[model samples]
Target: MITEDNDPRKGKRPDPRLGSGEAPDLGGFTMEDGTVTFDWTQTRVRLARLADAGPVELGRRRRFFVARDDLAGVKLEFVPPLVQAIPSTCQSLDEYLNWLPEGLGRHLIVLIQAGASALGLWEEDRLVAHKAIKKYVVRGHGKAQPTYLRSKGKSRYGSRLRLRNARSLLVETSEKIHEWRNESGPFSRVFYSCPVRIWSGFLDGKPAPPLSKEDLVKIPLDVARPCFDELLRVRRRSLVGRVRTLGDEER
Candidate 1:
């Protein structure tokens, strides 16, 4: 059994093949019942991390992973780009999306700033992993805050950036740095276009209860809709009020 300190991919369900893909598999797991379970692999672990943070059990062995990455593993930061714009080397938004992995951020940065970058884990080279990471606004509706306040909003709504529902793994491992580098040009401008910091979390590659489609569909929208609706109302109300007040407030 590989310890967490030594093997970065330790406990990850290894595929019965090479990273390039081949056979005999690299990792396996053994159950308490002494039963043998095969066909389990690491690629699954990568996909699992994207959704949930936990160790996955591969084939049959004492195989398992520590659930959830430790705090030190996650790092978060913002970086603006050297150029005023991002060059996707492609034409349309769909072409860009099609060119990369899921959960990307071009549309997001375009709305927030001229350019930005995001760094996280990759499953078979996708922006997927154990600890989630991404960018968002300080308020539920604006760009990331210059500074986080005490979050005076109702306790029901804790922090605004968190509300965007983006999280990043902070672990400064080779993998973490690798992901950041891919997004460096657009993720930030802090380090000559490198990331100043990034949100990170330990990824033990352990498997946990899988998130069901029902759970994914209902939970977030239910939690976020209230505040989103309120922010929209606040903006509209402020806009209309500005029209009425400009004529008289000057006096």
Candidate 2:
């Protein structure tokens, strides 16, 4: 359970709808604080109780519930840990809730930007291995200068160099990821955020990382510079579940 002392929304004013006595139309409700989070253990317990007491609506990334009596119109939305993917076999809400993992298991995080990338292998909550790579793939202006850009002399030469370096970075990153997977057995999930422009290059490397389409879960939060510490921070945030209150209209 999240306490008021450490709640992400502690300093913000409580939503007025939460205090209003009128029955909220499903569409009339507003988002409350999302800082109210639950760990996997707490999440499973809470979901189980809700399933027993009321009906649940499931979505790809979230779940919804409404209670009876005084809580009839208040909707509760549950967000699961972003690092994990819900199994496709759970066709019913009960089955999905029952299948929730007791805790986060083995996973890999891959963060990539224009000229830098970071990788980390984690078991439960501990980061066992990590690697960070940097290369001169982007020009000083912060954009990737295309090798095909029609330019003269030095400008053209620089673009070609940057393009070559970019390819090298992709190959090296893919090799490292494959090596880690070999050494660590297998990762249950691979959470990654790579730019669209570089995604194809990474996947088409001479020896691409052995990542399955189903197991490739994208990191949902905005990340800063890729580094070892940033990987740890992302892992912590991924374990936290965000809550939003919906109105009857949301049903």
Candidate 3:
């Protein structure tokens, strides 16, 4: 009959600061329901100071989060004004901060699945250009289904056609992306959600988009079927910052 507090399996909470050593004196912040959020304009200065101080731990290279040792139970997370690559953990706080844009800039968003994709370029918060591409890449009746490469029945011919179209879709997607960048100028960042299976084909296009791996930030949220409206929803959500506090088990 071990009580909840007496459970031996539960260890003491680890410092939320991610063990950067000594804790700083962050006394005024509060976490409601283990989380909080801050607006970019209001908190940028305060965030800069926290990053400059010592004994901080970074959570992830993408969708960056930082916690100072002094703030033992709370973590400060950053959401890019739009989707963008974040500096790696190896980089210094100054370098990380420098990577963040002072204000929103033009960015590209690409949502891709087996048979469909949506691409859009945005300036500030306004969508400037967008395109949606779809193809018959799926076999049978299901939506966005992949072709069965080894089918032995009459579906085999259809499967092969689907596979070929899938490849073509990737090439078309890449070409369109390239065209947009050429007409609109370089994008500050590229946010994409391309599946691993098609990633090589996506990049192998003869005139692929001028995207560098370092500048690509994978979309972190689940997206429904690729469409222009879905792109707008994702863009809006990416700009909001979220803060989370560690629970006993999490710490």
Candidate 4:
């Protein structure tokens, strides 16, 4: 069902906060129309005592187990709102829309993986950085080739896009459609990467980091098929501290 032609971003669109701090220079990116803008505030939700500003739900939501069998959790829920998230070193594009929230100045065209939350960022008075998004891997790539049109004509270089379903019109395929006509790969996406950090403490605040089938043996795990482990029955907390930045320059 892949259809979004020309897609040089089809007409383009991005940047959203929804208030007044500024948001318009878009073909360059600097958005922050403001509705809840503190520019995604950044990690604070630990209040079981820090005087408690909110978000300390942590235990007692019950009925979720594994070695005992109860299961059933991920239908979606958890939409408190506020987001504008891009962070993998941010090479440029105007220092990543001046760090977004208004600077999404390139006419705001997100989805090279959240280009760091521009769509008005979750209006309600921004400052979102409540934290807990760990291990993000946004990723991006779209050089066509996954086609399905086969035919369409109009002329004058406008409408005539064909490539529809070629499962056997020949033979050899699927190296991601031979790297989408391989000029050396990635014909459209250009390039992208993600880290998106902000995680401070999880498994309790419930921001979705619970997987454990033994945490799938440390990392590269991808065997989905109803393997919904639910972090092996939830109870594993103890992060609360970690900063790392200097390019994650650890030792």
**What lDDT score belongs to each candidate, Candidate 1 first?**
0.25, 0.65, 0.62, 0.20
Query: CA shift at 97, candidate 4, in angstroms?
Result: 23
Give the C-alpha lDDT of model 1. 0.25
On TM-score, the leading prediction is 2
What lDDT tens digits, residue by residue, belong to model 1 across residues 1-251?
Answer: 43212334434533211233432233333334332222212323332442253222211121122222333342111111111111234353233224333222221110011112232222331223222133443455553333243334343344543533323222223244444445543232111112222211122212211112221111111111223233222211111100011122222
Residue-level lDDT tens digits of model 4 in 5-69: 22243243222223345422212111232111111222222111221322211111211111111
Clashes of each: 54, 6, 3, 52
Pitting candidate 1 against candidate 3, the one with the higher lDDT is 3
Question: How close is every model to the real structure, measured as TM-score?
Answer: 0.18, 0.77, 0.73, 0.17
**Looking at candidate 2, what is the lDDT of residue 63?**
34
Off by over 4 Å in 1: 1-133, 141-146, 150-175, 178-251
Candidate 2 to native Cα RMSD, angstroms: 9.3
Instruction: State how far residue 181 of model 3 sits from its true place (Å).
Output: 1.5
Worst 10 residues of 2 by lDDT: 21-30
Better of 2 and 3 by lDDT: 2
- RMSD per candidate (Å) reads 24.0, 9.3, 11.2, 21.2
